[model samples]
Target chain A: MAWVTPVTNRNATARMTYLDMNRISGNISYLYNYAKDHGYDVQGDDVSQTTWTQNDIISYDFWYSMTGVLGEVREAAGLDKSVNYPATNYYSVNSLERYTLYTWMEITEPPEYGLLQNREGIQLQTESGADIEAGIL
Target chain B: MPTISEANKMQIRQPMDIMVTLQVGGDVSLTYSGYSDAKVADGRLDEPNKKMMPLTDLQGDGYPLNGSCKLYRPGYHPTSEEKWGERSNIGEPCSITITASESIGYVSAWVSGCESVTFSGNDYPVVNGTANIYVEDTTATFTFNPLYEDRRIEVSLLASGAYFIFNNDQIISCVVSLRSDLSLINPTLPESEIELQIYQDEDISERLASIPDETLITYSAGYSDEMSPIRNFYLSEKITWADNVMTIHAVDAVHKLDIQLPTASLLTDGSSDTGEATEESLLVFIRACLLYAGISIGIMPDYEDGASNSSLVFNRISLREAIAKATAWGRFGDYPTTWINYVDAGIPKLESDYSSAGWHIYEEDCGDVKRDAARKIKEIRMPVSALSFGDGGNYLTTNVGTGTWIYGSGAFLDFDDDVFAWSVITEQNAGIASVKSDETDYAGACERNALNFLAIKGLMEEGLPMGSMNTFYTQVMPWNSLQLATWNRYIGSSVREDQNLIIIGSKVLKDTHIQSFSTGEDDGEIITLDEAPIEGKLIVQHLNESAQTLYPNIAAQSILNMSNVTGSFKWKGDPRMQPRDSAYLHRVNGVTELITIENITITHEGGGTSAEITYRKGKC
Candidate 1:
């Protein structure tokens, strides 16, 4: 199972939490830019968000919507917005399927080195609840 | 589109008696609709003194809708009272202002019985026979001088020698326009439009009925020996027989690809093509598409899609849109159709332009660079939208998002589902690609990567971008894709340090799975379009080609963002000078510019050929 379950945290109050979500927000600078480029009049109040944003898609709907939008980008066949082109296994492409496997081992209580809101440093906790300051870049 | 040798060019340029053999399916007859009906028998419709032949229109624009199309040779000199053909050029003619109440169409003094001789104009001294009149709603006096540059001036009549001969039937005249402005990034060259007027003795309409749609019209131009490379094929679309002339209109092979193909069974997702051992390629897919389209293969690119037995993917769209979306890249050149010659003489068997088959990417990344002495001759892929191949689009970070809260267009476990629980495609919100280890349901969504792009962006062509002040016209190339040309067979990449994808115009529009499409009209049922706004299904059905769907799939509306082609020129005519042909255009200053042919307009009449070439400077 993925570390952050979408159903469980679709509307998380915190911003820029997950590494991949923030990274994908940075990976794609096209969402709002493409909307402007294609004359796709923005339907919501937030039309100004046109650059790199780690401000979260926030729900399964927006994430899948972005995926569907990717299908709109011209390419070979992999941009599957529908099942018509499904081998039914292409979703495992890259690390997508890998994340779906191996349950995320969560600890019931915070450990001695758990992260805190007041200060910012680095907290590395392994599956066995140990802490380390590896400083991994 | 073939490359003619310098010698062939010189031979074509040399003034010679170009033998013209033009024939339709059978005999045809055409009657000129001008002048007095009284003089129809003799073919002379002018006054005894000014016997000028009526002017014919070459292009289809500004065809006199009022049926009063009257034009006499302005060749007749009024000041010197010189006869027609005496002057080498057409100088301005004299005209006078007329009242708004006067009838429009020109009344020629040359015609057998036409005359509105109220008062003579300044130029004509002999007698008032020609009147270029203009009328308006109010009593405004209008000076009606013919705009020499209008569509009317572009036409020229085919002399008796240039007429098409087919037994008892005869072709009066024919005009053809090939390719278009270079900026237009269609997958392949567009269809050449042809219009012919035939004079018939009997009702050959019965025989002509068999050659309307689907029949390939094999048209060969230039000398008999050199005509092999100049032949073009067209599918007959419409034929109209009226006033003894058979008018036929046809298009190129792109039209033949409209039929639906079993894409699900042919083009799989290619899961095995992922990982290190796998990548992207368009070869097999292209062949498969052509087979389903029933189009014959003439030229195939060099790239190959990875292991053919990859996991199947699911996607449904129109065949035309599929071909337009899929692109390939390679080093390609045009040649004669001799490899796939006509079954019999003057008949082509679906050899629609072969160059279109290799319309995969050609010199995509190498942007607008002037002549690179190092790379002597390179290909010019149609300039697509900048967002296409390179420049990573909305890809999931790390190909799999860091599991978190998520929101997408489709429904899932909740309006706000956990990122790990995020999934969609139609109803279930489950199958992303497939179910994997520890996952209760499938969840691969959009981790997609684009190696190429659909060159469906519209092009705004300007003869001289530096000179034209008006807004350039945006023309959609309509057919090409990411198959931009490259020395290597990989899609251009700017984000990824390692270049991995390879495509050669695959069986892009294939069906790897053999599932039948439901024909039920449940897509929509519009009882009436009277008051209701247009529904999605109605729009899709009426659009016919599904071109309205995501298939025109161009990510951005790229208009004149990048332009390699600059200007154009005119030459007597070269059958070998097709659209997209790489050739040299010699300027008056003795400097020869290597140019890519963008648009070609050819007129063959009176055993003579003339071509108007729209070209761009050849570059990276």
Candidate 2:
């Protein structure tokens, strides 16, 4: 219904791309703020995600928990040893209902538009058989 | 299982009269050793059901073993004093006590018996725990601790016979505390100053002189099968005996007879100057006056039967003819009874008038002079001084002395300034004399009047001078739903409002109905209670039924439990329809099981029929 609006008139269209798995949860404000910094369009796919982003950003706090801890890197980086990030069980899959969107990239793809890295090593292709490029305006 | 004490095995002789307590503290298997006498024939005690069985036949566990029963032996006589006392002399004794209490400055107790004695103390007499040995009776004093200490008073009496005399029948002199400072300032009016005046057309002395002392006229009448059993018993068989009893009654039943004469009498001439003062006009005036009197002071004069459908028929005749005819009949009427006389007598052939038919005319002849007398009887009440006169203020025209005025009956043409006139009634005064002779006439009138005043105004004891308070004790029974509801609210609201002061004459039994008094703190005393009359119960039952009928959908079980229900039905319409008497019994006491109407009475008053219904709560 509604997409994120760009803060500057210099940006013709606003784009909201999820750089990683957490991008979908960070909400339109983070995308808008990022867009404002990079001078890009702040566009979001879902209106609910764009219209009221405060509720969504407050709920997406899982990223803050993991950033402070890494098992062996803490010793190498001189980080506090007592700091712990709760491990996520990736094997436990959530059942998909009607509203769930399953978007992932294929192998040999540089990256999807919004993801940081493709752990599954999937490649991205357009429906018109155009190869997904790593750097796009 | 444990054993019980021998003292605990007492029998409940009379259940309803007394409260019993059963205390079993220890762990126990309780059983009732059914009662038996302890006499045996041969070394064996003959006890009935000595082997302990289950307390009751019904199967139950941890059930209540202590309860009260209403079914009791009525003939249980408590200990009496005549049997307890050898001889007693009650003398006049005065005791005074100075009280620190704010309202009460000093209190004096006057104990009267035979001789006089005086005693003094502070606050109260120092007699508690003291023994006083008189010539005949021995009396002991005990300090009574009532629920409310304010009402506490030390009581002294011959305790042994007190129970017996109190329970069965005996009168105790209730000594009242008098304020010696309270003195009468004004002398009361003498008893003679209070006079009961009866204004009538004729002095009854002359008429009574020709009569026999005891005359019995009996008639048999059939009653409907639907009549109440009690009323049917009264009217059918008991009326004859009741009549005899009424004849013997002194004051209420024609005992004192005084004869006097008004200064003037009604005169009938051949012709009258004014056309309005004709026989018809005179009769109308008399009837009008009678109607006014009847309505103002609740009296119904029996004159004629109404339409066949009518219940109450009043005396309705034009003024001139009524007076003229009454005067004529009184003058020339014979003692002999006739059929036409009976028809004109208005003896109340119907049931409604049967009770009050005594006032109707029984027998009289209308000879030749009737027409002449009728013409002249109309000119009398012209308000002109010469036309009429009456006795002086100090003297009243009583039922004593004759010859001053041609009263009782007789046609007249004289104009006297001072005479008080009444239409002369004789055996010949048709429609009046016979109805007035019924035995129930006067009592029924009193009952009707009393009921009207009470129901309309909450006060009782009417028809008396205000100063005559001693004649009747004023007992104010609350009679409205609102009042009753409020009173009950007060009672349950707090322990403060639960206080009650029951003052009967001098014996004041206070501190009753208080909640905390149940814990044996109240003064142990007995009050001789008088049973309430039945008429009050009838009124209460009527209200209960009316409330039910008026609000069929409302919950009546709780409403009926209310203490007082108030509304008006006195002198508002037909006197009979109004509720005058209240029945204390109708106030709910025991638990109500159901509402059922019973003993309905339908009668006529003031030209209308009235219906009364009473209900009882229980399985009939």
Top candidate, metric lDDT: 1
Query: Over the stretch B26-145, how does candidate 2's per-residue lDDT look in tens digits?
Result: 111111122112110011111211221111111111112222101111133212211110111111121211222123211111111212212221122222122222112121121112
Task: Report the C-alpha lDDT of model 1 over B1-620, residue by residue, as the tens digit.
Answer: 22323334343443222222332332212222322111112222222223333222112232121222222323233222222221111112222222223332222222112222223333321111223222222222211222342212111121111113232125455566776333323333245566666666657576556554655454555443354342434546566778777776655555555655442322233333222111122234445655676665555533224443332121233454344333211112111111111111111122222233211111211122233222211222222111111111222221221121112121121122112212222221212221111232233232211210000111111110010101111111111121112201232333223222111110101112111212133532222111111110000011111112111112111111223346644456555455555565555445666665666676665545565666566521
Tell the DockQ for candidate 1: 0.00
Go through the candidates in order and give each one's DockQ: 0.00, 0.00
Query: What's the TM-score of chain A alone for every prediction?
Result: 0.28, 0.24
Location of the lowest summed lDDT over 10 successive residues in candidate 2 chain B: B175-184
| Candidate 1: C-alpha RMSD after superposition | 40.2
Chain B TM for prediction 2? 0.13
Docking class of 2: incorrect
lDDT of 1 at A28: 28
The residue-level lDDT of candidate 2 at B439 comes to: 16
> For model 1, how does the per-residue alpha-carbon lDDT over A24-105 read when each residue is reduced to its tens digit?
3332223334433555443322222223222112232334444333333321111222312211122222122121111111
TM-score of chain B of each: 0.38, 0.13
